[model samples]
Target: MKAVIRITLKNGVLDPQGKAISHALDALGFKGVEEVRQGKLIEIELNENDETRAKQQITEMCEKLLANTVIENYEFELTPVVSS
Candidate 1:
């Protein structure tokens, strides 16, 4: 089983890094660079099979170690890849 976690800042949070990226893009003449936000993606491999339990555990992991919940929000998806 593989889990992909995406951590992003909640709306109304100030993202200085994203703003810097946007400014750089504008300096490069990229059109329509309306907005940008930075986030973190984490991939984990596990042996768990139960989707519900696995999601719960992973969400706990995110809350504990993966993300700082003070200003960010995180979501995770579990992918089960069958071996042929």
Candidate 2:
């Protein structure tokens, strides 16, 4: 099993890095770029075969360590790994 997690800052939170990127884009002549939000993606390969159990475990991982529940939100996608 494979789990992909996307962690992003919640609305109303200050994102200095995002602002910096937006400014850089404008400086590089990337016009019409108003705002930018930065995020992180985490990919995990799991040994569990059961989809239900894998999702549950990944959810726990997010809550425990993967995401900061205070100022960030996370979403995940699960996919089956095909063996060659």
Candidate 3:
């Protein structure tokens, strides 16, 4: 199984990195770039074949270590890995 986790800051949380990127873009003449929010993408390959179980495991991983639940939110997508 293949899983992709996306971790991002929640609303109202201060994102200094995102702010810096936005400012840098404006300086580089990337006009009309109103806002920027930075996030993380994690890709994992699991041995588990069951989609439901894989999702559950990934969710737990996110809750325990992949994300800071206090200021961040995480979402994931699961896909079957085809053997070639």
- For each candidate in the order shown, give its overall lDDT on alpha carbons: 0.92, 0.96, 0.95
Model 1, 1-84: lDDT tens per residue? Answer: 789999999999999999999999999999898999999999998788888888888988998999999999998889996867
Tens digits of per-residue lDDT for model 3, 1-84: 999999999999999999999999999999999879999999999999999899999999999999999999999899999989
What is the TM-score of each predicted model, taking all chains together?
0.90, 0.97, 0.96
Compared with the true structure, what per-residue lDDT tens digits does model 2 show for residues 1-84? 999999999999999999999999999999998789999999999999999999999999999998999999999999999989
Worst 10-residue lDDT window for candidate 2 reads 26-35
By lDDT: ranked, best first: 2, 3, 1
Clashing pairs in 3: none
Ranking by TM-score: 2, 3, 1
What TM value does model 2 have?
0.97
Worst 10 residues of 3 by lDDT: 28-37
